[model samples]
Target: MIKEITCISCPNGCEMSVEVVENKIIRVENNKCERGISFANEEIFNPQRMLCSTVKTSDPKNLRLPVRTDKVIPKNKIFEAMKCINNIVINKNIQMGEKIIENLLGLGVSIIASQSLKINSNNV
Candidate 1:
């Protein structure tokens, strides 16, 4: 079997091809670094996503903001993970790179604000 992927680990986005036998990767090509190799193996085995979406906040004027996790969660738990993210309200002044939820939903990934949300007086 053969699989193709664009490596997201680097800006090059090297177009890589993997040769698999019996569901196992036997060879890889077009990868200039280890990152590409790792990415390909993960994709060929357990594909995951670094979800990027907005969550509704408690503030009325600024009700929604972008958020993401420090690590990618299991693809099988995408819906469940989104549910957990959706239920959260970041009222607290989230700092840049602050860890909002540690190991969210036990996926071993922490949910965090992609951009800091400040506590402004506008929120009444």
Candidate 2:
């Protein structure tokens, strides 16, 4: 089967066509750069997309925080990964790069604070 795509890795958005059999890319076409080729190969085999979502916090005033992996996890493990992130409850006065969940779902990914959050000490 042939799969076609418009590459989004750069501004050029090169139109690409790739051949796949049993989910493995055998041929790639129309890409003018290395990034497009890499993206096409990954898109066909071991396809992984990013996940971005909000996580709950222990502080009422700071109810949610944005979290994501620095790299993409396996596609099938996304939900399990999400579960790990969902259960996290960050405390007040958290700072950026603070670990929120460790080895999330055994995916070797961690959810962390992208920004600092401060909460009322008494309520939180």
Candidate 3:
């Protein structure tokens, strides 16, 4: 089977054709760089994506704290990861890049704060 895909691994966005047989990549064409080959292989076989979302916060000034996975995770597990993140509530101040959940879903990826959230005393 021939599949067409646009490469997002670089700025070129090269559109390429990939041939697959028995769930394995047979050939790739029209790719501008080596990264496109890697991208095609992973995208076709085991796709991954970085999860960016928000977690509830107790701070009145910042009701939602931005968070994201420190590394790309299996695409199939994104929903499960989101459910876990949604259940967490930050009860205190946190800094940007601080780890919120370590080894999320045992995928060796950590959920971290994308932005700092500090409780505002005036809001209390």
Candidate 4:
């Protein structure tokens, strides 16, 4: 089987084609660098993606705060991670880079606040 993929490891976005037989890569083409080969293999065998989304915050001024995983998570677990993200409400004054969810789903990745949220004066 032959598969085509676009490398996202860099801005170049090298388009690559791979020839596979019985779940093994036989050849690769259209790669500009060694990273392209690695990207294709990982994409085909174990795809991963970084998660980024907004979560509810306690502050009225900023009812929602942006969050993201510190590292890439498995593609399959993205929806599950989203579920965890959606269920949480940040009741604390969260600083940028604060951990929202540590070791999310035991995948060794933490969901962190992408932006800071300060407590509303009215709430104090």
Quick one: best TM-score, which candidate? Answer: 4
Task: Give lDDT tens digits, candidate 3, residues 1-124.
Answer: 9999999888899999999999999899999888989999998999899999999988787899999999999999999999999999998889999999999999999999999988876774
TM-score of each: 0.78, 0.81, 0.92, 0.94
Q: Which candidate has the highest lDDT of all? A: 3
TM accuracy, model 2 = 0.81
lDDT value for model 2: 0.78
After superposing candidate 3 on the true structure, give the runs of residues whose Cα lies further than 4 Å from its correct spot: 122-124
- Put the candidates in TM-score order, highest first: 4, 3, 2, 1
Per-candidate clashes come to: 0, 0, 0, 0
C-alpha lDDT values of all predictions: 0.81, 0.78, 0.94, 0.92
On a 0 to 100 scale, what is the lDDT of residue 38 in model 3? 98
Q: Which RMSD does model 3 reach against the true structure?
A: 1.4
TM-score of 3: 0.92
Worst 10 residues of 3 by lDDT: 115-124
Cα lDDT tens digits, model 2, 1-124, are: 9998888788899999998898677878899988888988766666786667778888887789887676677778888888777777777677877777767677777777777888778986
Please write out the lDDT profile of model 4 over residues 16-83, one tens digit for every residue. 99999999988989999999888988999999999999999777778889999999999999999999
Residue 81 shift from truth in candidate 2, angstroms: 0.9
Which whole-number lDDT from 0 to 100 does residue 41 have in model 1? 82
Name the lDDT of candidate 4.
0.92
Candidate 1, lDDT over the whole model: 0.81
